[model samples]
Target: MIRIMERIALDDDELHEDFMRSSGAGGQNVNKVETAVQLRFDVRGSPNLPEGVRGRLERLAGRRLTKDGVLVLTAQRFRTQERNRADALERLVEMVREAAVPPPPPRRPTRPTLGSKKRRLEGKRIRGDVKAMRGRVEGD
Candidate 1:
C-alpha cells in the first residue's frame, strides 16, 4: 500500500507495470534489456481515491490519462529496470500527492475604489494633456 496523504492510502494492486526496451544511452544493454517501466493506475475505478482527488487527478493527468480513465507514467531515466520501475512509481505517488490537496477558494470580484477610479481618470487626463501639447502650437 502507498500512502498519498494522511487519510489517503492506495492499494498495491492498484498499480500495473509493464517493461519495454529503453531508448538512448546504454548502447548494447539498451538494445537487449527492457529497462523502461510503464506504470498505469485507474483513476476513476480506484476505490482508494476520493471523488474530489479522482477528478483533480484526471485533469492533472492530461495526455497521460486514457479514455478508460487509466493514468500512464513512463520512466526511462535510469538504465536499470529496478531503478526505472521505482522512478515510475515515485512519479505516480507525486502526482497523486498533488491531486490530494484541495483547490484554493475562488477569488471574489471587487469593484475599484472611488479613489482609484479618480486616480486613473487623472492619469488619463494628464496623458491626454501631454499628447495635446505635442500638437502644432497655435500662433503665440
Candidate 2:
C-alpha cells in the first residue's frame, strides 16, 4: 500500500506502469533501452480515495488526466529505469498527498475599521494638500 497520509492509502494494484524510450542525454542507450517510466492511476475508479480527494486529485492532475479519469505521469529525468520508475511513483504519491489535505475555509468579508478609514482619509487629504501646493504659484 502507498500511504498518502495517516488515513489515505492506495493499493499497489491501483497503479499501472509502462516503460518507453527516454528522450535526451542517454546516447545509444536512449534509443535502445526503455528507461522512461509512465505511471498511471485511476482516480475515478479507486475505492481508496474519498470523493473530495478524488475531485481534488483530478483537478491537480490537469492535462495529465485522461477522459477515462486516469492520471498519467512520465518520469525520464534519470537515466536508469529504476530511478525513473521511482521518480514516477514519487510524483504520484506527492500529487495524491496534496489532494488528501482539506482546503482552507472561505475568507469572510470584512469592512474597514473606523480608525483605518480615518487614517486613509487623512492621508488622502494630506496628498491633496501636497498637490494643491504644486499648482501655479500666485506670486510667480
Q: Measure candidate 2: CA RMSD.
A: 2.0
Put down candidate 1 lDDT per residue, 66-115, tens digits, no spaces.
Answer: 99999999999999999999899889999989998999999999999999
Q: Model 2: clashing residue pairs?
A: none
* Model 1, C-alpha of 121: deviation from truth (Å): 4.0
lDDT tens readout by residue for model 2, 8-35? 9999999999999999998999999999
RMSD (Cα, Å) of candidate 1? Answer: 2.4
Cα lDDT, all candidates: 0.94, 0.94
Cα error, residue 51 of model 2, in Å, equals: 1.0
